[model samples]
Target: MASGSKWTYSQNKRFEDVLAEYAEDTPDRWHNVARAVGGGMTAEEAKWRYELLVKDVELIESGRVPFPKYGTPPGEAAAAKAAARTGRRG
Candidate 1:
């Protein structure tokens, strides 16, 4: 995935857990969190993903959108496109 774009559930969960280990208001905290996430994640990417998650969660909680589950296509259109690419039936 691109930086400043989508984040997987595991990534987000790891970010949350790792974020708590840092002291309150630590400078360069996002860099540490990115390192903790591993897989060549950049600090800017981690910070952007975290902020995106917060906004998405807020929208979901407020009934603006449904909560997203891991590994599921965003919608039927996406699912159909994926199925076509994989030559699989939906």
Candidate 2:
């Protein structure tokens, strides 16, 4: 895969699994993560991807991005209305 290519769902899942195996203080953590993630990803790419994931989590936690409602069908206005009435952010 090219350096600029986006990660596939499987690749992202593998990355997350591998990341959990390697702690932040682990030596050569990025290299290990890249090797585990495979798909021709380099250490820098794995590190960058992790950083992006962290930023995404931060945004959601800060309410800058709405939390996704899983299993909600498209055009489900009723769910949104119910959530609004219950004072829930989604």
Number of the top candidate by lDDT?
2
Question: Which candidate number would show the highest TM-score if scored against the true structure?
Answer: 2
Q: Candidate 2: lDDT of 45?
A: 85
In the order shown, what is each candidate's alpha-carbon RMSD? 7.9, 8.0
Query: What TM-score do all the candidates reach, one by one?
Result: 0.60, 0.69
Which window of 10 residues has the lowest lDDT sum in candidate 2? 68-77
How many clashes (backbone N, Cα, C below 3 Å) per candidate? Answer: 0, 0
Tell me the whole-model lDDT of each prediction, alpha carbons only. Answer: 0.78, 0.82
Extract clashing residue pairs from model 2.
Answer: none
lDDT for each residue of candidate 2 in 12-80, tens digit (9 for 90 to 100):
667889999999999999999988878778899888888989998999999999985645444466879
